[model samples]
Target: MRHGKQTPEPHEHGGDEGGVLVRGARRYEWSAAVGMLGRRRQVYDGLVALSGVRPGDRVLDIGCGTGYLTRRVARAVGPGGTVVGIDPSPSVIGYAATRAPANCTFQVAGAQALPHADAAFDAVVSSLAIHHLPADDRVTALREMRRVLRPGGRLLVADFSARPRHLRLVNLFGGMTRHARQHHPMADLADLVGRAGFAPTGSGDRWPSLHYVQARRPLEDVSAGAEASRP
Candidate 1:
């Protein structure tokens, strides 16, 4: 989630500040109380639809936690396709690896320093996790997403656009949603994606708990031509 502002006080997940809530909220016992709100399903289904994932395509899931969505994407992409799920947290990444399918792989890495070749993937996606970074890191991560995506590849990022409460609930419920700081930086996200060479053509549904932003990379720079304009 590219929240427009770059410097959030860093909503700590699993009780670690100065760090993007590394472990998702599910790490806590109370997460189930919060999850029944249908947030997970909304996010899971939304990303699947936004990515338009098909068989035989390479997909990258950044900040993947518990491999919940990663496993699903792996199945959707099928045999010929490959799915790579990356996250910086060892605890969560370890959990993700156990669920890895034959076509899916897991890695422990940071969004700003992705360990992949340029133009190596067909799609790059993240869910409910981007807001934990400082604004500058947010931009760097977007560029990394594009650098790893093949030309014409798609990107789907979903974040918490709004929360009923801010910092208080963030430390309390950060497991269920890392970017739970109540405030959203959607505008900054738009700018970061634009600068990272993406064209954001759609805004996802805004519910009381979440908001999503979707964009795609162009086949060519068309930096100064009408041929590049999106309808």
Candidate 2:
């Protein structure tokens, strides 16, 4: 990874809520903070597995702060696959780009307004990002995710949950952390996914402090006969 290099300044993006931005040294500090939570590698790897991404799948990572999970996903996708990560802060995008693998790319964008075309990705994943969005934009972001995914594509959204009050207390220690706490429960997430036209497949909590919802875009009906056959 490149180091001691000057990075670009932060830029604005289109979204209902601008959300929190972690820039410059704060990015490194946030990385260190997440590490303190313990089992950082394993936790992130579990998210990649839960995403159900194949070797050649195209993946999109929304609100990919510092590209930590993006890099992990790059490994899962291998050399053939590509992972594009978007965040509103250009500084973090620059930071992530410097450390990005060949198969990974970073962009300045927002969760509610992705820059990709329709059905552009095979899998879409976001971690600890849903809470960062405004309450009004959360469902819009989920719909945007669904719009970018191909038919039958998988989606994994992991974020802090309402349970585990101690973890919420930990977030109060820092301004950045404060905004990262649970804004909604897993049921809310399921509701948003369903509203976005995705079929919910699973939901659960992981070790440490994370709740994830797995879903998929419904496949298009190939024919009227096929549609009628379904009970």
Candidate 3:
């Protein structure tokens, strides 16, 4: 998520100084919850495969909580490649950096304002992260992802589908539809990716509630795309 000043906090409705209180005023660590999500290796593997990462490629993992997916990508890219994991949480970034390989790096940064040059990455990927963003930040984040990608660079976004099958019970009983509604349906995600100047290639479900959309920037007019990112 962007974690921008314009967007409301996830627990803005009610929470102590620490984090969100989901049930009976139970305090939950937001970063810890996200870190646990990183251990869903099945979804991570599926997303990495869909991303088409290759040896010697340069990749950026947005909202890369704890670097689970980032390490997988680094292995795929091999020693010749470089993988950078960026997240808004400094604690997670610090933890990720400790375990990261020489070829991999972690940074504390938001997706909406990436600290990278235009056309810097061969592939840009995010998993289970975008849904946390507010509506406007989602667009800006998508555009920012496109801005950093090389011409014809691949884009892979993996998140829960709007009507998630796995979390159906939670959605119904826990009054979690508010969260579910934040997730984009397949069509909406495709449209957003397209509007961000990426050509939609395809999309598919990976594991329950986990789906991915694949896209790429056009090869022609790479320079124009770079110029457009300038202030």
Candidate 4:
């Protein structure tokens, strides 16, 4: 059920380091795992709302495993808009591509080095994926996200933020939940987003185990605007 070429070249930025990639049959397991959380549709729909994405906005989804959230964003954007999803795993990318809506597309790339032009998207979002990134790479990935967004674009990042005791019990069984157990504190994520040059807007927790931070790229880049105007 794969689509397009088996291996499409990734973005020119090229680094594929940081974060774990889900591959093979394991990629198919996410749907069930997510269902265990209950209210799956509502949780993800809430993320779409938190993202502030509107119809006709060009959106990007980083670490878009299985395209679950990407598909939802596509619905929000409508046919006038387009959604591009990137993940480091070719397997999941292929899986996602098969089910992608006409206005959506999938690519193989990592969060730290997104394969898109600067100021290309109207909004950027990630769900339950930031925790999969290595600590050092998280900021770098956020910077990349900021770079891809147009001035005034919205940014939303959600990840597991369950208390340690709760995570410990979940991690005992291993698998994907292991990453959740080791996720960074949501405060750290807020700080990182700020450090990446986004203006903090809001943050909160979703039922089950997701924490989200919302921010906006400053409405203007004075230095960049000055440089452009000079020419």
Candidate 5:
């Protein structure tokens, strides 16, 4: 298996041998302060290639720890567009809340049960996350992402591949102490996206610790009523 020169930091729920999660989320400050310089470039390159977020577009950034990417998305979408960054961790959200640009906003929310309406966003993006939740939740969250997107909206997810057979196992072993769960291998990610009513945009680079899936919700039959409401 290929390994990165840079090891992922611990997730908040430290320790292994419990729930399926993998490594804990790194300290929010570390990611916000310096991680953005590199991750932001990757995100910008991917979103621009896949979603084509124009000025005035409404965007949602899930798992937006530190809101760094949210800030970048906000800048990309410009004054006309709006970007909302969401994370379940209050600490991460707190950091992001204070520093986000005027056009950006933040909320405390989980991926599976996003507190948004059908077709609420023009584009949705996530990075370095998604594997922390269970396989079922991953699918559920993807469906939620599709539900909130405008007809013809875009969904861009940048994460480590659950792909290659051995990588996931390694993550589980390495992250046990770090509190991370390993879910669907990379091969299954496409199927999950398809099951969620998304058509593949197919621009993924499975190298240098980055894996991504970009999908589009066709405008032809996007039904606002088809969205499932959460309790």
Candidate 6:
């Protein structure tokens, strides 16, 4: 439905305001050089199946590197619905823009400070982006995702497994773990989402490394003990 204007370059979000491990533009360039090895399709199917994305749902994809998953989401949501992908890199958005269908748009934005208003989306999905953020930023980003969801909306995050033993050999190499140093273990990620006000639903790994977790905002405001106090 609504499309954001195309940006040629990523707007500077400033230096390591909480130690952002990966800068957007740099990451985009690197990804372009290396190429995505089925990551987009793999994560798209996993996230879609896990989130139960349906027709007419307004979805948001955070860190949508090149709109691969965003395009998939748009297809799932159909013409009646809309999908928006946000990434820190304008170059990534530019690539995404060319391939994006009419129902989807790509914007340059960070997870910690989403550009949308509260309760703007029906479902929020993030893949392989949280670990790139600093310890505190991860929590803040999660909270921001929750804030932008309507009541009972779901959030799904897929990323590398934090458990050292579970990682693939490539992930264990030098400096590969730099951004991932602060990656939350499955349990920790669940707890962090719970603390951010979502009710953790489930978590699991996709074989060797990638881990996915799902959580949902409560339909009723339970933070004030109102729901718990109810008989």
lDDT of 6 by residue, 1-231 (tens): 223453244322211245343434344434423233436466567678888689999999987767777888898889998999997766667667888899999988877778887778899988766665666666777777887888888888877665545333334543433333444454466666776778888988874366788988788843422222223
For each candidate, the alpha-carbon lDDT, in order, equals 0.65, 0.74, 0.69, 0.74, 0.65, 0.68
Where does model 2 exceed 4 Å of error? Answer: 1-18, 21-36, 163-187, 221-231
lDDT of 2 by residue, 178-223 (tens): 3334333544777777776788999998865578899988897123
lDDT of 5 by residue, 115-184 (tens): 8988889999886556656555667777888889988898888765644343444444442322222333
Candidate 3: regions farther than 4 A off = 1-39, 163-187, 223-231
TM-score of 5: 0.73
Which pairs of residues have clashing backbones in candidate 4?
Answer: none
Q: Please give the RMSD to the true structure for each candidate, in Å.
A: 8.3, 5.8, 7.0, 5.4, 7.3, 6.6
Once model 3 is optimally superposed onto the true structure by TM-score, how far is the C-alpha of residue 192 displaced, in angstroms?
A: 0.8
lDDT winner between 4 and 6, please give it: 4
Question: Looking at candidate 3, what is the lDDT of residue 221?
Answer: 38
lDDT of 5: 0.65
Q: Which residue runs of candidate 5 sit more than 4 Å off their true CA positions? A: 1-26, 29-49, 162-187, 224-231
Model 4: lDDT of residue 142:
85
Error of 2 at 30 (Å): 3.6
| TM-score, candidate number 4 | 0.80
Write down the TM-score of every candidate: 0.75, 0.80, 0.74, 0.80, 0.73, 0.73
Cα lDDT of model 1 overall? 0.65
Give the clash count for each candidate.
10, 0, 0, 0, 16, 0
User: Across residues 28-72, which tens digit of lDDT does each residue of candidate 4 receive?
Assistant: 345335433556678889999999999999999987877878999
lDDT of 3 by residue, 155-195 (tens): 99887665555444434534423433334454467777777
Q: What is the lDDT of residue 128 in candidate 5?
A: 59
User: Against the correct fold, how does model 3 do in TM-score?
Assistant: 0.74
